[model samples]
Target: MRIIVYGTLRRKQGNSHWMTNGQWLGDHLIDGYELFSLGHYPGVVEGTGQVYCEVYRIDASTLGELDALRSKGGEYKRQLLQTPYGSAWLYVYQRSVAGRQRIESGDWLKRDAVSE
Candidate 1:
């Protein structure tokens, strides 16, 4: 299974421990979306902007683990979208991003520049 990660789950991001045993495919640019900083992690929405993401090839077991984490909290909802790497799963913020800081660069690492 292909998973597109834009925030903490990315290679060196904070919560990467949840994605063990996955192979790093490569970096990808997911279109029609924007990234926002929600304090600790990032939130992506279906809108405008090029969201930089890392694609990973994860097995069924890993996918289940990811699904549990993504949905365990009400903050996010998992969804699939077509990327250059093929079909991939990504998490979208379920709450409002009104006051959240926007990651204009669309890069999760760069989000620290303006995040709280």
Candidate 2:
């Protein structure tokens, strides 16, 4: 299945830190989606912006592993969203602050770009 990943996973060499690592297929621009900081991790939501994302083509067998890494029913939830790339599932923060704006398309905030 094709999955769209945003947040920390999108950062250079960041997603590799996880044991259940996914292959980086390529980068994509998700229209009507926005990026927001959810706790220490990053997530995306439905909005009017172009959210930069990393696309991953993974086997269905890895779903369990991915779910575990994402803390199933915890910090994040697996959601199905329709993006320009295609229909896919993503992990997003369950709780979010109201009125938060997401990153524009092709405008990913790299680790070095984030102010401490």
How close is every model to the real structure, measured as TM-score? 0.89, 0.67
**Residue-wise C-alpha lDDT for candidate 1, range 1-116, written one tens digit per residue:** 89999999988678888677888888999889899988888889878899999998889998888778877768788798887778988888888899988899999888757544
Q: Quote the RMSD, in angstroms, for model 2.
A: 4.0
TM-score of decoy 2? 0.67
Q: Whose lDDT is greatest here?
A: 1
Model 1 scores a TM of 0.89
Evaluate residue 96 in candidate 2 and report its C-alpha lDDT on the 0 to 100 scale.
68
lDDT of 2 by residue, 40-88 (tens): 6666666677767777766776766777888665867788766555677
Give all candidates' CA lDDT scores.
0.86, 0.63
What stretches of model 2 exceed 4 Å from their correct place? 17-21, 82-86, 99-108, 111-116
Q: Which residue pairs come into collision in candidate 2?
A: 35-102, 50-105
What lDDT would candidate 2 get against the real structure? 0.63
Tell me, what's the RMSD of every candidate? 2.5, 4.0
